[model samples]
Target: DWVTETIVNNGEQYHGLNGDILVWNPVTKRRHELTSMGIRVTKKTLKIQLKMSGQEDFLNLPYHQALLNDEIPLSIGGGIGQSRTYMYLLRTAHLGEVSVTVWPKILKDICAQKNIKVLE
Candidate 1:
C-alpha cells in the first residue's frame, strides 16, 4: 500500500485497496475481474475506525468531525491474492501463482509458449 501523509490531512485520501481475481484465457483472449465486497465505512464509521485505530487526536478537526457525524460517504476495499498460496500451489513465479495482473510482456510470452494455465 502507498500513502502520503498530507493527503490524509486534507481529507483527500485515495483508497485503491481492493481484492479482485483476474481470469485470462489465452485461447479466448478474454479477461475477467471478480470482486467480493463488504459494506463501506460511513463518516460516522470513520470516526469509529479512527478511535479504534487510536487516532482520536483528529476528533475536533474538520475532517474528523465530518466523519464522526456521518457527513461523508462510506467506502470499503482491500487487495486480492495470497502470495504463498499461489507460489507453492502453482510452482510459478510469485505473481503468476495467483490471479494477479499486469503480467510483464516477457513473462506473458513465456507463459503462453509453455501453455501455463491460469486458474482464477
Candidate 2:
C-alpha cells in the first residue's frame, strides 16, 4: 500500500506513541505521514520527556497521572489518514484528487503544472 520503513527518535514523546514511519509514493514523489504505531512509554520515560519538553505540569493531569502511576495498560495505538490511503490505492497523484478540502489556488496551480489533477 505504498509503505516504507523509516527510523524515528523520541517517537513516544513527539507522537505520543512509538515507531512512527513515513508513507511514501516514489512514483509520484508524494509522501504522507500515514500512521504512527508503537509501544506506550513507561512512567520513567514519560517523566523524562515531560521534563525535557517543559511540560512536566502535565504530570498532574488525570491522564498523565494515571500513566505515571501505571494505572494505564501498556499498549500500542496510532491514527491512519483515510484520504491519504484512498489516494494511494486509487493511484491519484495528489491528495486533492481524493479529498474535497479547500486548497489555495497557488497550490492547485502548481499541482496542475506537474500534471497532477485535483478533483473539484
Candidate 3:
C-alpha cells in the first residue's frame, strides 16, 4: 500500500521496479548506487511488472499463482548490502567479480545498466 503510494507519488520514470536513488561517489567523483530498496509488489503490480519485462510466463508458476489467487497477502516486501558495494569499491566491471547471490531482477537490471554484471 505505502510502497505503491510512494512510487506513484514520486512520479519518477521506471521506478516501479528500479526504486533506488543514486548518490555521488565523492572519492570516485561519479554516481554511485549505495542502496537498492523500495516497496514490495502487490498482486496488481506483480502482474504489471511481469508483463512489462515480457516474463508473463512467471504467472503460471506456483508462487505467482498463489499471489494471483489471493492466497498471499496483498502486502509484500526491499534490500541493499555489502556484496555489490564491494564490487563498486573495487571498481570492478561485474559484481560476480566480488560476490555471489541469487540476486533480484530489479537490482540486476540497475547494475546491468551501469555495465556491471553479477553471478548467475
* Regions of candidate 1 where Cα sits further than 4 Å from its true position: 1-38, 75-120
TM-score of each: 0.28, 0.45, 0.42
lDDT per residue as tens, model 3, 74-102: 55431244654775777765546577678
* Per-residue C-alpha lDDT of model 1 across residues 1-120, encoded as one tens digit per residue: 112123455689654344445655343345543343434555555555566668878788986666566686344234442543344344554346466666778877787787774443
Q: Note the Cα lDDT for every prediction shown.
A: 0.53, 0.67, 0.67
Candidate 3 residue 31 C-alpha distance from true site, Å: 3.4
Per-model root-mean-square deviation over C-alphas: 14.0, 8.8, 8.0
Which candidate number would show the highest TM-score if scored against the true structure? 2
Off by over 4 Å in 2: 1-15, 19-24, 30-32, 37-80
Q: Candidate 2 versus the native: TM-score?
A: 0.45
What's the lDDT for residue 57 in model 2? 93
Tens-place lDDT per residue, model 2, 1-120, is 011234356543223444455777765886665555554566777777688778889989998877667787644332236676776678777778887777899989999899887877
In candidate 1, how many Å is residue 42 off? 2.6
